[model samples]
Target: MVASIKSAGKLSESSIRSQDDLEKVVEQEQPKKKWRWRVDTSDAPKEIFNRTLYLSILVFGVLGSARGYDEGNISGTLAQVSFKKTFGLSDPHKSKDEVANLKSNIAAMVQLGSIGGSLLAMYTVDRLGRIRALQQVCIIWIIAAIIQITSKNVGQLYAGRLIEGFAIGQTTTIGPLYTAEVAPPQIRGMCGCIFAGAVYFGIMMGYFANYGTALHMLNTSQVQWIAPTSIKIVLAGLIFIGSFLLCVESPRWLVKVGKVELAAQNLSKIRHLPPDHPYIVGEVADINELIAIEQEAISGSGVFDKIREILTVKSVRYRFFAVATMSQLLGQWSGANAVTIYSPELMGFAGYKGVERLKMTAVLGVVKFISAYASAFFIIDFLGRRKALYTGITLQMISILFFAIFVTVVPNATEDVPLPLTASEDRAAKAALASLYLSGVGWTMGFNSIQYLLGSEIFPLRIRSFAQSAIMVLHFANQYGNSKALPKMLLSMHKFGAFYFFVGIMAISLFWAWFFVPEVAGRSLESMEDIFSLPWYMIGRKGAELCPDHSEVSKIHVNSSGHGNAYDGKLDYDEKTSVHHDEGNSLMVKDSNEKDLEKEVKK
Candidate 1:
C-alpha cells in the first residue's frame, strides 16, 4: 500500500498541475458508465475509522446527552408528585397560571444560564482548546448536579439548574465543533451528526429513567425525581474521564494557534498514518493555507478585530447570518425544543394520563433517537444536507399542521386540565399523539441535527469558535423564550394556537432554507470558503455548483491495464498504482478501475 501510494504521489507531482489536469487524466484513463444515486463514502480512507477516532467521537458526542437529559428529564421531574410538593408546585392555593409560571421559570433557567455559558465558551474554546473546555463543562455540570440533588427548596433547585445550563451551553458549542474538526471529510456528515444523535440517546435515557422511577417507586417518593436528576452526574463523570483517557485535541484547533507541527502530529495520529504520508501532509497543508489566508485578511490580532472581521467581511458576514443566525433562530422557533422539553405535557394533551404520559414521552424519545441516527447513517449524506433539511422540515410542517387541526376541532384537553374524552375524541387524541411523534422524527432529521452540524462546519476556523458560540447564544436564548412562554402560550393562546404558530414559523423556515441553505454534504472544512465565495444572493443557488469539487478528491483508483492508475492517498489498490497530490488546491485523485471507471464516466 505504501509503495502504491508513493508511486501515485510521484505521478501526481509530475503530471497533475490543476483540477482540470486531474479530471482530464481521469477521463482519459477510465471507461464510460451509468449514474445512480447513493451515499458516497469512496473518498474516506478505512484508517480514518480507527477505534481511536470512534472512541474520541463517542467521548465528545456523549456530552450531548447532558443537554438532552436536561430537556427530557425536567418535564417528568416537574410532574412528579413528590417533586411538585418539594418545590411548592403542588400547593392547593396556587392557580394554574401560578403553577405554569413556576414551571416556566424552572425550565427556562438552564437556557438563561446557557446564554452566559455560550459567551464564556467563546473565550474558553479558543484559549483552553476543545477537550479542555469540555472537561471544564463536565466539572461545572457535576457541581450543578450535586446542587440539584441536595436542594431543599425551589430557589436552590433553580440555582442548580442555572449552573447546569451554563455547562450544557458550553457542550452545545464545543462537542459538535470538535467532532467536525476531527472527522475525515468523506464521512464528516455522519460523524458530525453523532453529537446530535447522542442528544436523543440522552433523551431516551432520561425518559426511561423517569418511567422506571415512576413505575417502581411511589410518585410521592422524593427518590423518584432525585434518581433521574442524578443521572447527570454519571454522564458528566464519564465525559470528564474520557476527555483525559480517550480523546485528543482537535488538530484544526492545534493548527489555528500556530502549532502546525503539533497539528500535523495529532492529525497523523488520528488518521492512523505516518506524518510524512502524502494524505496527512496534504491535509495539514490545506489547514495551513486556509488559516494563513484568514489571518492575512484580518487587520489585527485582537479579539475585537476577529469580531469585526465577521461583520466587515461580506462572505463571512453573510455566512454569519444565513447559516449561523437564521438556522438557530428558525430551528428553535420551529417549536421542536418545546416538544422535546415538554413531551410529557404534550402527551397529556394527547390524552395519555399519568404514567402513560411518561411512557408516551419515552416513545417520542425513541422515535427521535432512531430518526436522528437514520439521518446520520443514511439521510444527510445520501440525500445531501439541503434535501435532508427540505424533507425533514416538510415532515415537521405536515405533522404540526395535522396536530393543530386536530386540537382545533376536538375538545380532548386544556392547558389547565385533562378532559375525559369521548370515544372519537380519544381516537383523535391518538392521531394527535402520532403527529407529535412524527414531528419529533422530523425535528431530529432536520433542524435538530443540521443546526449543530452547520454551526460546527460552516464558519472559517478563525471565526468558528466565536461564530458557534454566538449561534449557541441565539439557540439558548430562543429556547429560553419559547420554554418560558410555552405554558402561558398553551393556556392563553389555546392549545391549538401554539401548533399553528409553529406551522407558520416552519413555513418561513422552509422558504428561507430553500433560498439560503447550501448543500455541504461531503465538502472539507478548508474548502468551505469556495462555497461562501459567491455573492450573498448567489451563494444558496450556485455555491455548491461553483465551489471547487473537493468531494471526489480522496478517490482511489486502479485500472485493469495496471498503467496510469491515479491515487488520492487512500490505500485501495488492485495493483501498483500512481497517486496524485495537487498540493496547491489540496486535490487528491486516483485513476478509475473498470468499476470505478464506469461509475465515474456516467457522471
Candidate 2:
C-alpha cells in the first residue's frame, strides 16, 4: 500500500509495505551533507536548537552557582582579619595547632552537611519530581544563608554552613541529571558542560565578592564577611524564581511515571516539533521500549529489587563502579577541590601575602571559568570525552609535579607567616604559582567538566536518581576528607609531600580512564545500553565499532493510511523484537512473516 508521511507541514508519498521499505524511506529523508561547526550535528534537526531549550538549560545551569559561591567565598572569608578576631582565631592563648583544627572544622562543615544532603536527595528526587526537589533545595539554601549572615558567634556560623551544605549536595545531584534528560543527543555534551561551567562561574563571582568586600569594607566590622556570605541568598532566590517561570519537568521522568501523553507534549515543546513528527514519535517510542525492557529484565518494582539488579547485572554494575563511583572519587582526590577551598592559603604558601593573595585567587577563578567554557565550546564535543580526559589529566599531572619540585627545593617556613626568600627562591615561588593556575586550567578542561556529564548520562532511568545520589554522597565525602586533611597534610606530610601524593593519584587516574572510560560524546541516553553491552574489557576501546547508532537498530514505520501514526520497531538484548505504538493512537501490526528481519545485524 502507498504511504503518505507528513513532516514539517510537507507530505510525501511512498510505498512502505515491509520493514525494509520503511528503512529506505527514512534514510532518504535524512540530510545527505554533514554539517560541521566545531562539532557535527548532522543527525540533529535544526529545530532542536530552539530558544526554549537554551533558556531551560540556562535556568537549570545556574543551580550550580550555589556550590561555586560557597567554595569560592568561604576560603577568603575565613582569611579576613575581622573574621578571625570574631571567631576566636585571633586568641593569643590558642596554639597554632589548635587554630588549625578550628579552621579545618569551620571550612569542612558544609561538606559534612552535604553528605546528609546527598542521602536525602536519594529519597526526595524520585518521590518528588526534579523541579520540586530543586525548589526545596533553594528554600533551604536561603534559610541557611540568612543564618550565616546573622551569625554572632562561631557555633552559629558552623550551623549555617552545615545547613547550606544540604542544598549544595542536592543541586549537584539534580542539576546535571535534569540537563542531560532535556538536552538533544547532538548537543548533550555541550549542555552538560554548562553545569560544570556554572560551577566555575559561581566560584568567580564568590572570589570577586570577597575581593570587593575586603577591598572596600572595613576590616574590623563583621560586614566584611557578612556581605560576601549574602551572595548565596541572592543566587538561591534567583534560581527558585526561575524554576517556576522558565523551567519545565523532565520528559524522561514523565514517561517513567506512566504519563505518556504529558511526556510527548513536553518533549515536543523542548524539541520544537509537532507531536506526530517522526523525530518526536521515534524518541518517545525509544524511551518506552527501553523502560519496558529494563522492567522485564529485573521483574520486580521494589527498591531492593533495583539495588539487587544493579549489583547482579554486569553492565549496570560496571556503569556504577567504573563510570559513576570512580569519577567522583578520583575527581575529588585530584587535589583541585583543595586548591579551590584553600586558594588564599595556597597563595600564602607560594609567598603572596594579604590582599595580593586575594587578587591572585580572583585571577585563579577567572582562569578556571574561562577554561571550563572553552572546553564546552571547543574541546569537549570536538575531541570527544576520552581524549579530553587524556589531555586535561596530563596537563594536571605536569603542573602538580612541577609545583611539588619547586616547594621541595624551597620550603615555606610557615603558611601563616611569609618568610624572606633568596633571589633564586623568589623565581621558584612565582613559577610555582603559575603551575597552580595551569593545574586549574587542566582540571576544568578534563575531570571537572566530564565527571558531571558522565555520571548523569551513563545510568538507566529506573535507578538514575539512586545511583546519582550515591555518587554525590561519595563526592561530598571525599571533598570533606580533603578539605579537613589538607592543612594537616601540608604540615605533617611537608609542603611537597601532599602534592606528591596528588601527583601519584593523578597518574593512576589517567591510566584508569584510558582502559575503562568509553567515548559517549554523540550517543543518545537510550542507546547507552548498546555501548555497555559489549565485553567489559572492550567497551573503552571497541564500543563505537561494535555498536551501531540507534537509528540503524530501531526503525520507525509510518502508517500507509496517513493518520500520522508511527510504529516503533526495536531490538532488545536477547534479540527479541518489541513494537511500541506512538501515543497509543495506532493499531499494532503483525510481522509474523518477517520475524528475523527485526534482529540487528551483528558485526
Candidate 3:
C-alpha cells in the first residue's frame, strides 16, 4: 500500500520522503519478540481505581452472600429434629434407605432447576443484556423464596428449592462475568474474588439464620422451616433493586453490538476518567481491536455459521470443551457437594447428631467462608490463579482421603444407634470432623472460586456469554448428579467409598489441569481471543500471542457482525497490500476460522 501511494503534487518531494521515513522509523522501533501483555494495575496511581468501581463489584459480590445463605441454611434445616418430624422424612414406616433417597431428592432438586436456569442464561445474557438478565433472575429468586416460606407439603418445598436453584445458577454465571468485564485488567481478579467471598459470606449467613430459626422457634410448626427460607427473599429483594440502579451494562458488550461511542462513555464511567483520557482511549482501542480480530474469524457469516465452526473445528471444540465443560467436571467430581450438603449425615458417620451435628455443620461453613475470604483477598492473584487452584486441589485430595479413612477405620456407633458417642468415639469423630473441615477449606481456597474466575477469563467477547452459560450448564448438571447420588452412594456403597470415587476423580483432574489449564493471569480480557484461537497443542504452554499495537490494529476492519472470514495479510505489516494478490488458491479466509489459522498452516 505504501509503495502504491500516488501523489497529486500538492506537496514537495521532501514531504513525501518524510512520510516513507516515518513508516521505517516505526518498523525499526518494533520489538523483536512477542509474549503475553501484562497489565499491572496494582502499581497504578490510587486514582486509577476509584470508589465507583469498588462499589459496583462489591454490590455484585453481595449477590454471592445470598447464594451462600441458601446453601448453608439447608444443612442446619436438615438437622432440625422437629423439621424432620413435620415432614415425615424419618417416619418409622419408611425404611432407613427410603429416607435417605427422599433426602437426596430434596437436596438435588434445586440443581435440576439450576440446569434449566443456566441454559436460559446463555440466551438471555446475550440477547437481553447482563443487567436485565440479573434483574429477571432476582425476581425469580424472590418468588421461589415465597413458595418455600408458604410450602404446605414436601412437594411444594421441592418445587420452591428447584425454582430458587434455577435463579442461583444464572446469578453464579452472570455476576462474576459482569464484574470481570467492567473492571480494569489490573484489578479484575480482585473484583471477581469478592463474589467468591460473598458466596462464603452467604454460607455463613445461612448457617446462622438456620441455627437462629431452630433456636427461637424450637416448638413452632411452620416457623422452623419458614424463617430460614425467608432469608433468601430479603437478599433477592436487594439484588432486584440494585441490579438496575447500581449496575452498569458491560462496555465490551456495547462495543460488540456496535454502540462504540456509548461503550466509551460507559468505560469512562467505570474508569472515573473522561472519554478522551489516555487510559480510556487505550482500553476502548483494545476492545475494538479484539472485536476486529474476532470479526475476521467469522467474517460475512451469520451467527449460526460461527456456531457450526466452533462445533466442527477439532481444535476449537477441544478448547471450548476443556473450559466450558471439563473445568466444571473437575470441580463437581471432587465430592464437594456430597460432603457439604449432608453435613449431618456425614457427622453421623462420626457419631455427632442433633444440636451437635448442626453446630459442627455451621462450624464447617465458617471454615469454608474464612478460607474463601483469605484466598480470594490475598492468595488468588498473589499465587496466580492456576498455581493456587492446582495446589489447593492437591490439598483437598489429601484431606478428603484422610476423612474417608477416619470414617472407614474408626466407625461411628451412631451409624447403628442414635445414642451419644462414647468419650473415645467423640474424640475420633472430632478428628474426622477436622479432616472434613480441612477438605472444605482446601476446596474453597482453589476450585471454589476459580471455576467462576476462569470461566470469566477463558472466552472472547463475542461468544463469552454463550461459553460461560455452557460452562454453568455443565456446572449445574454435575451438582445435580452429585446431590442425587451422594446419599445413595453413602447408604449402599458406604460413605467412605464415595470419598474414594472423588479421590480417583481428583487424581485424574490433576492431569487434566496440567494439559489444558493455560496461564492467563494478568492478561487483558481483550487478549483472551488470541488464547482461545490457538491450535490444540500450543495451549497450556504459551497462551494466545499478542497482536499488533493500537495504530496498526485500527487498520483492520470489523466485519458487519464483528467476525470476518477473510485475511488479506494486510494486518501482518510485513506484507505489501495488493488488491489482486493470491495465496495459492486465492480461497484463503473462505472458511470461518481460517483467519487465525493462516499463520499456523503457512508454517
For candidate 1, list the clashing residue pairs, or say none. Answer: 8-578, 8-579, 12-580, 566-590, 566-591
Range of the 10 consecutive residues with the lowest summed lDDT in candidate 1 = 569-578
Query: What pairs collide in candidate 3?
Result: 68-202, 68-203, 69-202, 295-562, 295-563, 295-564, 296-564, 299-563, 299-564, 299-565
At residue 144, candidate 2 shows an lDDT of 98
C-alpha lDDT score of every prediction, in listed order:
0.82, 0.82, 0.70
Q: Kindly list the per-residue Cα lDDT of model 3 for residues 106-154, writing each as its tens digit.
A: 7777778888888888777777777888888889999998988787789
Candidate 2 on 303-322: residue-level lDDT in tens?
78877977998999999888
Clashing pairs in 2: none
> Which candidate number would show the highest TM-score if scored against the true structure?
1
What does each candidate score in C-alpha RMSD? 5.5, 6.4, 10.1
**Taking the tens digit of each residue's C-alpha lDDT, what string does model 1 give over 323-390?**
77999989998989999888888887787788998999999999999999989988887788888898
lDDT score, candidate 3, position 467: 70
lDDT of 3 at 535: 66
lDDT of 1 at 253: 94
All candidates' TM-scores? 0.89, 0.88, 0.81
